[model samples]
Every structure is written in C-alpha cells, then in structure tokens.
Target: MTETLLPTATGGEARSAAWTALRRVRGHVALTLLVLTVGTVIGLVGPWLLGRIVDLVIDGRTDELLPVVLGLIGVAIGQAIGQTVGTAMVAHVGQTVIAGVREKAIRQVLRVSEGRIERAGSGDVMSRVSGDVETVNEAVSGVLPTLLDAALTIVLTAVTLAILDWRFALAGLAAVPFQVVATRWYLRNAVPVIRAERVAEGSRAQQLLDSINGANTVRALRLESDHLAKVTAASDKARQLSIRMAAVQRRFFGKLNYGEFVGLALILVVGFYLVRGDLVTIGAASAAALYFHRLFDQFNVVLGTFDTAQSATAAFARLIGVAEMATPDLRDGGETDSRSGRGTDGSVSLRDVRFSYGADQHTVIDGVDLDVQDGEHVAVVGTSGAGKTTLVKLVAGLLPPEQGQIVLGGHDLAAGASGSGHRCVLVSQEVHVFADTVLGNLRLSGEHTSETQARSALDAVGASGWLSTLPDGLDTVLGRGGHSLTPTQSQQLALARLVLADPPIAILDEATADAGSAGAKTLEAAAEKAIAGRTAFIVAHRLTQAARADRVILLEDGRIVESGTHDELVDANGSRYAQLWAAWSTHR
Candidate 1:
C-alpha cells in the first residue's frame, strides 16, 4: 500500500470561494449596477406616464391628451434605450465573471493533489468543467439582474399603489402570504428532487463516458446490452427525478398564478365598491387598476428571481466544493535548490520506511530499509501480492512512507520537495503516451533541450529507427486517439525520454514488459548504456535483466527474503531467484 496524498491548493470554505470569485470583477459589477439603476428608472417612467394619462382623462383635460401622449412615447423610447444599455452592461459583466470562474476552476484543477485527481475520476472533472460551470453562467448573468429589478419594482409599485388608495393597495397585497406559503411548500419538496436529478445526471454521464472509453472491452466481452441496461437504469432515475422537479415547479408557479387571479379580482371588487361610495375618483380607480397589474407583475418577477437564486445557490455550492479542495505542499520560495541542479550522484536511501493505503489498512512497507549506491544496479524480485510496487513507489518518491524518510543525494524528500525528486525518474510497464510530439514528450523532462540533444537521446535508445520513419520525424504528433505507436515502440520511446531526463537515480518497474524478450533485450542494453555510472533499481520481469544487475533482492509478503548478487542467488540451488531463473529459462 503506497501512502498517497491528494493534490490541493490553499483554500477556505465555499463562502470564501464566492467572495473570491466576486472580487475578481467588482469594478464591472459596479458599472452593471449603475446601468441597471438607470434601466429601472426608465422602466418605472412608462407606468407612471400611463397613470398620469388616466388622471388627465378623468379630470376632463382633453386639451392635455396630445402632449401627455407624446410625453409617454418619449418615456417609452428612453426606457427602450436604457433597457438595451443595461442588458449589454450586465451581459459584459456576466461574461467577465464567467471568464474568471473558468480560469479559477482550471487553476484549481492543476493545483489539486495528483492522488485526489486519480481518485475523483475523469468523469466528475469533465462534468464540473463542462456541465456544472455552464449552470453558473446563467446564474451569474440573469439571476442578479432579475433580482435587482424585482426588488426595485416591488418598492416603487407598492408606493404608487398606496398613493392610489391605501385600502385597495392593502387588498392587492392580501394574496402574497398564500403565494409565499405555496412557494415554500414547493421549494421544500423540490430542492431535494432537483439536487437528486443533478447527481443522477452526473453519474449517468460519468458511466456513459466510461462505457464509451472502454467500448472495445464491452464489445469483446459481449456486454453491450448489459452496459446499455446500466446506463438506461441511471437515465431512468435521472428522468424520474427531473419529472419530480418539473412537477414541483409547475405546482409552485400554478399557485402563484392562482394568487395573481385572486388578487386581481379583489382589486376590481374593492375598486368598484370604493367608486360607488365616492371614496376614490374614476381616474384614481383606473390608475390603481393599472398599478395593481404592475405590482403583481413585479411580484411575480421577484418570486421568479428568488427561484433562480435558489438554483444558482446550488450551483455555487458545487463550485465552492471544487474550490475548497486542499492544496498540495509544494516547495516554497527560497526553500528548494533550483530545479536547474545537475545532480549526477545517484545514492538513494530509504530508512525505516512504512506505508499503508489507509489508517485501518495493514502496512505494506513495514520498517523497510533499502539503499542503492552510485553506479550500483539492483533488482527487486517479489512473488504476487508482495509489496513490490509499493516499495518501488516509496523509493521513487511517487509516495511518501508513513514513517521514516527517503533521501536522494542526502536531500530529504519533504512535503514541499516531494516531487523535487522528479529529477529521479521512474519508468514502468504502464506507459502513458501523452498527446504530443516525440520531441515534445522527451522535452517534458527538460523543455529547453535542443534538437541535437533530442536526436542523441532517441538514437541511444534504438528508437531513432522508427522515430526517423515518422512523417515529421521528431515533430510527428502521437497519441491523440488517431496517430499511434506500437506498445514496444512506445516503451522504447519512454526509455528514450529517460535517457534525455538523465536522472541520477532511475527506477525501472517492469519497463520493458510490453516489448517481450528480444525487444526487452534491446531496451535492457540501451538502459545499461544510459544508466551507466548512475544508481538504478530494476523491478525485472525477464531473467536476463536481473542477471545483469550488480545485486538482486528477493522479497516475499512484506519482507526481504534474500539479498545477494544474481549469480550468488542462482548458485543457492533451491533459492527463489534460482527457481525464478529456471522457470524463465524453461519458458524461453
């Protein structure tokens, strides 16, 4: 069990995340608010003019109709202009906020621990990157504007309605409590359902992506129907959850509509009785009626705005969850030797090392001690279920032992300097051919390598032959789901990179397994040449590579069963290495 920690960045809670995101475009936000205020003023003017027109008509001021009508038209035109500017301003602000969010999310992804990324799965990351972030775009843009407008409209309309007739205004607001209660009921039931729908949707997308990436395996095993069944079940669950969400929203809005109708009827009845009693003039009644519609219209907008806010809150929560991921303990400024160090001494040591997958898990490398001196090549052979890979990972700095320490060239690999040992390279049978050029891949070790250095590195690994045959030579693109190199050729290319990386210490964990005996022999010879005068540890698969080691280590369970030269181990008649060699000889 290799003790792995997640990659994360320095961060606080989701609340902090929202604040951090907002601070990115505070200036733009201020501008947007200013524009929205102007728009609100313009929007209110149109209704005010209508009310004034009614007042004029009722007062028998027929002479004032044309000017009043013209004034109303001018207000309408100004409202339209203001609305356009406000919308554009808000949109620009939203885009800037969205851009900031996208950049931050990507930065977070990069800062998170490598171990966490592996555990989280690619699908979740993809969902966050594409789907989850998309939800926030609408939240950032439309929700804020609508909420502002709703708040202002509610305030202005309530004031105007009260001026018309306090009795009628109070009557108009009577249905608000009913709408509020209904909305609360809907939200209480709907929030869980909406959240469930989002989770199910994410899971379905993840599983579908997994299936697509492994389509060859599914088809080979004739499990297409089984895969489809699993996906269909997830999709059905998502659909059911969505249906529940839709049902709740419909019921919530339906109740809102009912409240609107009830409120309007009350207004009409109350206005008519007030008119009969001569308590309010006809013009005030007509103006009040118009004001009633405006009040309710803005009330609906306010309610809808709240609904959007709820949805945005959920999305913000998810984004904040991502932002809250722990940061890695990378080396601080002035704490690390420059990455430019050209260390050539490969003395590697692990003292009293211990590691476990979890707190409750059994220790894999229990108090293990290992050392490889400069120019010494060692082979660690282990039976199945033994902690071979775990031990190798500890030595390679891919994982830190729970207890004890690893030292390369007397430098302790601490939290900040954990991957500082990247100068100590590890090549495993599981090769990752990145979507890049051959030269690009090699240059990952040292980005400033010249073409001469790259060509020399390729030639040293016997990969120069196939590499030269490529259409673009070292510039040929590879591993983009289109271009490909054979497993053997890819393994050779990996070795070529190791040659270029030129680490003082190298850990080869079955690096040539994909290449078979002949190809392994070629790679083994190349590795010997490249690793000369540097400390190396080979987790050998083929007996030939082990036979070439300066020493061989036999491990069983979590203990070193034997340690001696390969020739010495072979001569020990019934030794594990002797038996392993015999088996390999027979297979060959």
Candidate 2:
C-alpha cells in the first residue's frame, strides 16, 4: 500500500482540491452574492442622499429637510437589515461547507489501505481528523464573507466616486496598486509557511500522544526528559513559524495604514483647494470627499477578505491531503443481508503469493502456496517477525499480495465475491471495545443479528461471565466509564462479534494469547465448537493449540519452511515445527 506522501510540496493539487470544495458549496455562493449586491445598493444610496442634502442646504432651503433626513435614516435602516440577513445566510452556508469537509475527510481515512495507515503514523491521522479540519473553519466562516463584501464594496465605491468626480476617483484607484502589491507579497510567502506550520503542529500532537501511550516504556527506561525535549523542540519550531508569519502580517498592515492616510490627506487638501478656487462647488467637493472616504473603507474590507481567503486556501490544501491519503480502492454500497449465510461456502487459496509493504521493501510474505478447504482447521506457528500474521491478512483479503493471486471461492478476492459480509475475517491481538453496548458492538458487524443471536455468540466465546454480571446484561455499555472490561474480556468480545458475523472463513492471530492459559483453552474449545462447519486458520503461540490443528504450517522469515499434520511434523525430529513444539513444551 502506498502511504501519503506528505512533506512534498503539492501546491497544484491543493489548489485543485480547493476549487472542488468551492463547487460543492455553490448554493452558499449564490446567496452570498445576492445579499452582498442588495447591501451595496443600500450603502451607495445613503451617500447619494447625503450629497443631495448638501445640494439642498447650499440652495438655502430649510423646508422639508427633516423629511429628507428621515429618508436617509430609512435608507440606513434598510442597509442594516440587508447586512443582517446576508450575514445570517452566509453563516448558514459556512456551517454546511464545514460539515461537508469533515465528512469527506472521514471517508478518505477509511478508504486508505491498512498498510498505509500503519506506516503513515496513527498520530498523523488523528491530527488531521481533529486539528487540520478545524483550520478549514476559518475559510468557511471568515473567508467567504471577506470575499463577497470586498468585491461589492469595491465595485459600488468605485462607481459612486467616479460619478461624483472622475479626477478624485483616479486618486482613489491609486491605493489599489499598494494594496495589491503588499497583499500579493504577503500571501505568496505566507500560504506555504502557514501550511508548513499546520503540518508541524500535527507532528507535535502525534509526538505528545506517543509520549502518553508509551509512558510505561519511558518510565522503565528513564527517558522522561528525553521525550519531553523532543516535544518541546517541535512545539518551539511551530511557535517560531507562527511568529514569522505574524511579522509578515504586521508589515502588510503597516503599509495599508500608510496608504490609507496618504489617500485621505490628498483627497481632503485637493478637495478644499479646488472648491475655494471656484474650480468646483462646495457641494460637489463634499460629495467627492465622502466618496473618497467610502472607497478607502471598502478597499480595506476587500483586502481583509483576500487575506482570509489565502488562509482558507491553505487550510483547504491540508484537508485535501487527508482526503487523498485515505482514498479507498473499493466502494461498497453498505448493503447487508444477514439472513441466509452469505459467505457460508468460504474456501481460500493463495498461489505463489508474495507480498511487501511497498516498493523495494523487504517482503513480508514470500513465494508460498496454500489452500484452505471448506470446514478445515489449520494452525500457523512461527517465531517473532515470522510472516504468520501477514499470511492470515492475505487470506482475509485486507491486503492484496504484490506478486501473487489470493482467490476466494474460485473468484479473486479483489472481486469482493463473498457478498455483503466478507468471506474471510481476521481477529487480531489488539481488541477494540467502542463506546457502545455489548450487543451494539457485536451487531455492528451484522445488520440482521437479533439480541438472542448476539447473546448466544457472547456465550459461545465464554464472555458470559462478566457480561451476565452487568446491570443490563446484553444491553450493557462496554467502553470508557462503562463496563471497563480487561484485555482478555475485550478479546472475547471481538471473538463474540465474529461469531455473530459467522463468516465462512476465520483467522485468529493470538486471539487469546494475552488472556492466559485458561482463556486460551476456553478460546480453543470455543473455536473448535464455533467453527465446527467453517474454514479457520489459527496463528498459535501455545503448542497445545498447534497440536490440535488438522494441519500445521511453520513459517520463518517470510517463507513456509515446514508443513504437515502436527503429529507428523513433531515426528520429524529436526524440523521447524519440531523445534517450536520443543520450545513451547519447555516453557510450559
């Protein structure tokens, strides 16, 4: 599986993703533009009315002035109303956009290959889901409005200013050059910096989680200070990058303030001079000055919008990265038929199978041929780092072998031929108990499983001991502050789910290894009983489990070095299986 190639500059890809996200929220775009247009009309009408008031005052007419003033106030109120409605509409759009982004990110993570997830660092995935998605919220809430408001403000201000006086309008246009140049410089540099900073922050979060998860190891090894130093260093790098970006913003703001002051001063001096020289009327001068001030205000809003847009773009890129990393190879309609034993005839075969983690990596499984007949029991034995787990994964169809074919029921595993529930399933050493009831957790794998069926499965796995003790029995919650089951109980719960699923083929890798000998015996007997009429592969650590296998295979360094019935292999005095049996016996 190819993992996410982060830390590689993917600017072009990010831009494309951002545009796609924008397209997804087209409804919001339309509403924002409509509201902005109305708001701008109201805003422009108010200034024009003030200009008319000046015209009236110069004519020495005081009658009906109160009516005109009230008309202006009415226009102001209309502008306020338009802005309020527009803001509310935009806020709704922002929320919808964020929800879409979050869902897409989740789908991406789920679609990615299991091997990629393992190599990509669990911490990074967690960071992307929790932290990277939040960065995009700014784009939704702040960036969109900044964009619409800026565009409408600029358009209306420019038209009003030009109508008042083309010469002063030209001066108003001059500020654009400074604003454009400063903003361009800041954004061009800051986008990459901001993205890098976000990535670094994610790394830091991963490091912190690692420290917490490995707290026992650190304490035993006396490495507390060492781990802390690593976290501190990463955090410091993130802070420095943030400060540097802030400095860029400060410089940009400094230039904007200077440009605004210069534009305002020029308009005031030039307007008064021209009016006094009789080049224009005082009414015209007042109108032009008002237009000039409004232009500056609108221009500032526009620039602010562009800055937010840039930040949003950066956030969009990160979210896209998460999506791309987790893109699934196959799509399932998520339909299920739990009634009539969908994969009951499960039979799997691997021909010349060879597999690796990635390009040019050491092979995890090398050139092995195996067949699992329907309703047969097999045990796989190996030392640490043997490809036993990898082999089982191949049978379960979780990872497609790089060099060979894994066929299930005469059809390639890639075809997903076993129908709704998988033909083969693997239960591993690490068991997860989600925040759900005992029955909820079991029924998650099978849609139509009744409460009685789930309870039966739990009882089959010998998990009824603690489960029956619960207040709600089958309805009892299992995670967090709920039941707080031990590791052995958790493993049994996972097994219970499998029994509920009742896949034709099952692979159990150390399913009961951590549960002690009693748990192991219970699991072995349960497996023999539960898998009575189904194909099963067990990666056995205990010799007793291996001895009971109808057939046994010994793996070493990614290759099958020995295979036969357990008694037959044990009779071969110097064989790999013989040595394993001897070691297991000594330990017992």
What is the TM-score of each predicted model, taking all chains together? Answer: 0.74, 0.83
Range of the 10 consecutive residues with the lowest summed lDDT in candidate 1: 1-10
In TM-score terms, which candidate is top? Answer: 2
Choose the strongest candidate by lDDT.
2
Residue-level lDDT tens digits of model 1 in 1-588: 012222222234555766766688788778877776776776666665676777777788989889878977887887677767777777677667667666767667765644355556666667666776777678666776667666766777777778768888788888788788887887788777766665676678777887899999999999999999989998899899877777777777778888888888888888899889999766667777777788788777777666556656665565556655544443322232233354755777878888777678887878778887877998988877678877887776666668998777766765545444444678889888889888888887678988888898888877788877899988888997536988778877788788777777788898877876677778787777767766888888776888889999987767788889988999997898899888889988
Q: Write candidate 2's Cα lDDT for 1-588 as tens digits.
A: 113433222679876765676688887778777987898788777767776788788888778578879989988898888877887777677667667766877776765557766666677777766765665676656666656666787787778777766767777666667777777887787777876777777778778888999999999999999999999998998899889878877777777876787777777777788777877677677777787777777676666555556656666666677766533243222232465345556677888999898787898899989887878888998989889988898777666678888876565765552342256667898888989888888877777778888878888878778877889988888898788888778887888877776677788887878877777777777666666667889998677877887899889988988989988999997887888788879988
**Candidate 2 to truth, TM:** 0.83
Model 2 misplaced stretches (Cα beyond 4 Å) = 1-29, 44-85, 163-168, 265-294, 305-308, 325-328, 331-345, 352-364, 397-403, 410-423, 446-469, 472-475, 500-504, 525-533, 582-588
Task: List per-prediction Cα lDDT, in the order shown.
Answer: 0.74, 0.75
In model 1, the runs with Cα more than 4 Å from the true position are 1-12, 52-126, 141-176, 202-233, 262-295, 298-302, 305-312, 332-367, 372-378, 383-385, 394-428, 431-507, 516-537, 542-551, 564-573, 582-588
**Backbone clashes, candidate 2:** 1
* Sliding window of 10 residues with minimal summed lDDT for model 2: 327-336
> What is the model-wide C-alpha lDDT for candidate 2?
0.75
